[model samples]
Target: MLSEPTFSFTNFQQDAVKALLSSTGISLLAILPILILIVRQCGSAHPAPPRGCRRLGLPPGHSNLHDEFDPKYSKGTSKDVDDKGQPLWRVKALFTHPIKSCAAVELNVADVVSTGFAFDRQFCFAEQFTPDQASTSEEKTQPYWDARTLRNGHYSRLALIRPEIWVPDPAAPDYAPDLDEVRSKGVMVMYYPRPAGRGLSSYLVKLGIALRLLPRELSFSVPLVPPPDRASAYPPVPVKIWKDTPVAYDYGQHLPQSLREFLAPPDAGASRPLTLFRVDPTHHRQVFRNAPRKEELGFQPVTGFADAYPLHILNIASVHDVAARCARDIPRLSVRRFRANIIVQGPEAYAEDHWKRILIRPTGAKSDADAGVEVHVACRTMRCRLPNVDPATGIRHASEPDRTLKSYRRIDPGDPTNACLGMQCVPSVQEFVIRVGDTVSLLETGEHCYIKLLKPGEIVEGV
Candidate 1:
């Protein structure tokens, strides 16, 4: 027979104080500050690991080397505008994703389309799972994207292929990689599968080497809107697009058989070959983008594979602020984790939060609307745990950004726990080219909203 344990408050307090003064306790306290200092040093690295990384359960000895954010990218600054302030802020860096959740393609200049950036999130690889895999792992309970044959809708479900976007190191002896070389030839990517029966946790863990999906080896690009003959031959596959159900799209096997077999499991479990698709140019999947939902201030809200709005912007200052706060917890805090379309070095941290509308004009263009690109800041970007996953390693970090973010930015009522970082923006000027050096001018301001309110059955893909 076991006797009940008894506790006394006075006795407990005495023991606790004695324990704190013990040699073991004193040694722990002495090293605690030192351990914290070393970990905070990791804040300088790009593509950092999550807080308490040990709990994330990543593969052993994951590589930590990654390309640093270009100093030139720290190009822009902001000054207070008095009625009329000279264009103080400019586009520091521009990253466009030709495919959804793949590597980002850096661009010197990019054109804005009706939806957002041209070809941004325009292409995505859809996953097909057997009934068993779908039932066991996927969001089968949800009414949308609940197809065993094919699923497309959110990054939460999408298998994000973490291919290294930039390889800063040189391949040859006595030679260094040039910035020009990195811009031209990105990096090689290798695809490997997580252990079988691991389920969603496996997808969160990083895997893969740098590789490019090009025209060679069965990898090819098709027009956003395929030809009539081609469209008829491979008819549109009905998909659940947010509240809009049954959107038509042309689908095909974008990966070669060898690559498919490489990522396939040896166990021969129930799973289908990966299939890729692009936004149907015919339908364009026009969304009611931007605030108030009146119609993006004369511009249309259309998306290819983006979660909600087409454009997602991040500020270096904001990232720096977050990194500073949580550096002690998170080893490596980088802007790459947030993965914004445009990275601007603003006047102050979170300055972009107040911007309702901005116009990007030529460095010296006259005050003319037709001469520049205009974007309407949509809403504060609601974040998930993806940030904890390093872009280079594909391993999830321990609950850091989320933990620290919850401390201050827990303002989202829809999902109060979901923290926000960057602001989502949509193009108001339909078509225009935005360059890295383009100047930014505030066009309007308004109270920031917490969520992108949708109808009963609406959903989106993360950018």
Candidate 2:
């Protein structure tokens, strides 16, 4: 038998303490400070884990656990306004959807572009359809498809497909990425639930993933930026979106077979083949809704593939107000269902309804007027049943939020039949980076009537 030796100071310390107490005639109260100091120095028998490690279920330095209000993002101080002392609203959140109707990528900072956010609505899935009888020879060789999104309940499953934007890290100070390199090197990785049939093999696959022996989800990657050479070979084709037919590059040849099968599975009863498309930069489709202010704004704003306007801005408080009116059985609502690019806080519920023009600037700037980038609140975003779909679970609600919103939110003059939830916006000419916690100032407020105008031959391809 092996014996282990243990060290103890009990006897020696007790004898020493007795000798000291007797010789010095010191009371327990007199030595209390000394005893406390010794215990503190010795610490516990076992050292504790780091503060971050003590958290349950989350790894250290997780992005969700990170503090967006940290002083570093605001240049040492979190001043909401400049020297003017004007009241301002803070940017609550920033989101970019690299692919339309798919999951959004939450960002601490986002790059502003002429149309919208740098990567917002840059890619979309389309369903191939037959061309019109007036199509020319070129149309015969190349066919255009209709843009498919979560607006249609049949394709609501798209919300489950999570996309991660992988791009080159922006340099310091300005923190602007090289546009060309960002497009060339950028990749959008999408992950979805396993689409394969359930059987012995499927069970084994799921078991393997559970044990960390296999990849958790099925995934595919698409280039964030289309290569010029490949784009040229495809030739720009027209894709339909609502009332507009914008020319775009169809990357059907580049998409993987597995992704295609997953999107339109044989058992799912899909009517059309889903394909990927990127907006053609040269083909301009001006925002007809902004025509009233085009001359006053100097340039007409455009969009890549958004339904109407370039940017969609939502007020967090407004979403909460709508959710509050829902029935008790409904799940807790999230702001993500609305899918807005810039989400602002500090404003009253539905306060954006009267906003005409707004300015977004850094935390503390010298001038309030000229420091921030001006964004025009074009019109009210008409509500649709799309919001009925839950983003996290990709499950469609019977009718809670959309039903609640329509009951009291029929406020838009242009589209009085439908309810309004958010504001559609058009940004300024110059590009800028919008960081979370930046200040938002209401520049102008006025009545707005939503409008959708289609030119004579705008919807036809090769007109």
State how far residue 3 of model 1 sits from its true place (Å).
76
Residue pairs clashing, model 2: none
How well is each residue in 183-280 modelled by candidate 2, as lDDT tens digits?
45556667776665455445554555574445545666666657655556556778877767888877776676766655666666746667788887
Point to the candidate with the largest TM-score.
2
TM-score per model over all chains: 0.61, 0.73
Q: How far is 147's C-alpha from truth in model 1 (Å)? A: 10
Which portions of model 2 miss their true places by more than 4 Å? Answer: 1-88, 131-144, 169-185, 327-329, 367-370, 453-463
Model 2 has an lDDT value of 0.70
Quantify all predictions' global Cα lDDT against the true fold: 0.56, 0.70
Clashes of 1: 13
Point out where model 1 deviates above 4 Å.
1-88, 129-228, 241-250, 261-273, 289-296, 367-371, 452-463
Task: Give candidate 1's TM-score.
Answer: 0.61
Q: Give per-candidate clash totals.
A: 13, 0
